[model samples]
Target: MTQIDRTMSLVRRAVDERISQAIAERRDEWSDAGPAAAELLDAAADLLGGGKRMRAVLAAIALSATADSARREDVLSGRACAGLGAALELYQASALIHDDVIDGALTRRGLPAAHRRFATAHRGSHWLGDAEAHGRSAAILLGDLLLSAAGSELGAALAQCPQGTRAAGRAAFDAMAEEVALGQYLDVRTESLPLPDEGADHAAAGRAMEEAALAVVRRKSARYSVMHPLLIGALLGGLPPHGEGARRLAELGEATGIAFQLRDDELGVFGDPARTGKPAGDDLREGKRTVLLALAWQRCDAGGRAILRRVLANTRADPAEIAAAAAIIEECGARAAHEERIDEHAERARRALEALITAEAGLSRSATADLASVISLLTDRSA
Candidate 1:
């Protein structure tokens, strides 16, 4: 197998093993809690099972890139990589679960969303009042459970490393957790805020909207998705998390991650449901205040703006209305503008990657190449 495929395979195996262990432990501990509890654990397992494992792979690459040659193989094959990969996967699963609940998403990865699954089960069994409410509550608790498990696993993972590594890992972990939470809150708050007036200074209003949206992208997705993962791995690989090497990784990761999220925003509006596993225009229905939307609002005419305002956040919007909104976005060149922004971030990440390579910061050739591949995939992917 190619190095990238091998790395992905290793991380996937580690994550699967860790999740299975978690499920078994929970099952045994709650044996007396009945079948309902087992089902809950099963649901968590199901949600945790599917993902690109992109974060875990990034961590491994960072570790491989920085570790001493003699120790590299041992560490990559040992508990540190395994534990870190698993922890990152679990953490991502938790975030996705909570995010789906917040968005009131009905499906995830082509399957019913956690809340929707629970609601369906509730209705099927004809148990309890307010099936929808029960589903949301259950999904929230499930997300919390996974979040707790992630911390515990991460702590256990770092305990086997050196004292300095442990400290660095914990610090990065804590910072990432806090930042993402703040980002999510900001995103929710942005949804309630009024859109900029159409007659307002167009450039100034566009900048404001873009800045606010980028804030959400940076904290909510970028750092969480890339920077912290790379930092954690660098720490475990014996690079000081605050040192020059770590700083370079952070810069590259953040740039790559920003591109990744901007591409995600584009996909939400323009991607095929068959590939994305969500319906077309799902973001419009959910009224995601994305950079793409902000730019489109700035360029659209009054009628087009009215159409967007009416369709956004209106979950009941029909397909035709969604088509109208999407067409407006395309015709106004917002989609193209969004793509240009993604390209800009991608180029920034490329420059950072080149700088790191030129500095000869001890990254292995294979790992550096792998990092390059990941950056491309993240920014240019269709789904």
Candidate 2:
């Protein structure tokens, strides 16, 4: 098997084991608490059971690529890489839990969202007086618990690393967490505020909003999703701090991370509800100020502008209005523009790979190919 394949396999196994352990621990802690605890455990398990494992895979690949062949076997066998992968995966879980709460989403990964599921079960059994309130409370606590667990795992992983390597990895991980939170703040702020004045040229205001949205996407979704995890792995593998390989990874990471967020935005607008586990045009429903929306709003004239304002103002717009909004977005050529951006980002990522191959003599050709393949797979995914 290729190095990347081996790394991904190992990382998946590690994440699965950690998730199982977490569930067992949670169950044990609340064993006497009755069904609520059990429900929470089940909810967490459902979320953990299936995911792309992209972040964990990236971590493993980064570490494996930098380690010497002889030491690579030892690192993979020693549990250090697994610990790191598991920690990163847990962090992802925490983020998802919180994201569901923020979005008020009802489902994820084809299952009822953690909060909704817990709330419904509580209400059904007459266990809680206020089902919705109880659900939200439970989800918040559960998300916090998961975040703490992730920190513990990450600490263990760092302790296992060789002396000098831990510092860099920890620093990168910390920055990633902080940046994502800030980005989320920006996103929430944008939604809570009104759009800029229509009198000030609707297109100009829309363009400004798109810029703001992209900034958030870069910090919140891109950095933490792919770049930081990969960098952490590279650091743990004891690669030189500023070597050609390290530089290449950074360049490639930025490109792939941006592309990943763009794809998610596309999915938000157009993905199947059944497959995406989200409502159709959910971003529109949320009034999320994405590039797609910005472009569409910009291109509309007075009538189109009026239609957009009315649909967006309604918290419970009908399907026809939603469809009209989507149509206006498409008619404005925003969809094509966003797609073109995705392609541009993908090309940049590929260029980074090419730069790595050209500049670094020590990097294995197979490793480079594997990295490129994984990037392509992620960037080109439909769901």
Which number leads on TM-score?
1
Steric clash count of candidate 2? 0
Sequence-dependent TM-score of model 1: 0.96
Of the candidates shown, which would achieve the greatest lDDT relative to the real structure? 1
Across 288-373, the per-residue lDDT of candidate 1 in tens digits comes to 89999989877888898889988989999999999999999999999999999999999999898988787667888777888888
Candidate 2 per-residue C-alpha lDDT over 260-350 given as tens digits, one digit per residue, 9 for 90 to 100: 8888888877787767777777777777778777777777777777777777636587888888887877787888888888889889999
Candidate 2 segments exceeding 4 Å error? 1-7, 29-36, 68-78, 242-244, 359-362
Clashing pairs in 1: none
Every candidate's CA RMSD? 1.6, 2.4
Q: Which runs in model 1 stand beyond 4 Å of their true positions?
A: 68-74
Query: Residue 56 lDDT in model 2?
Result: 81
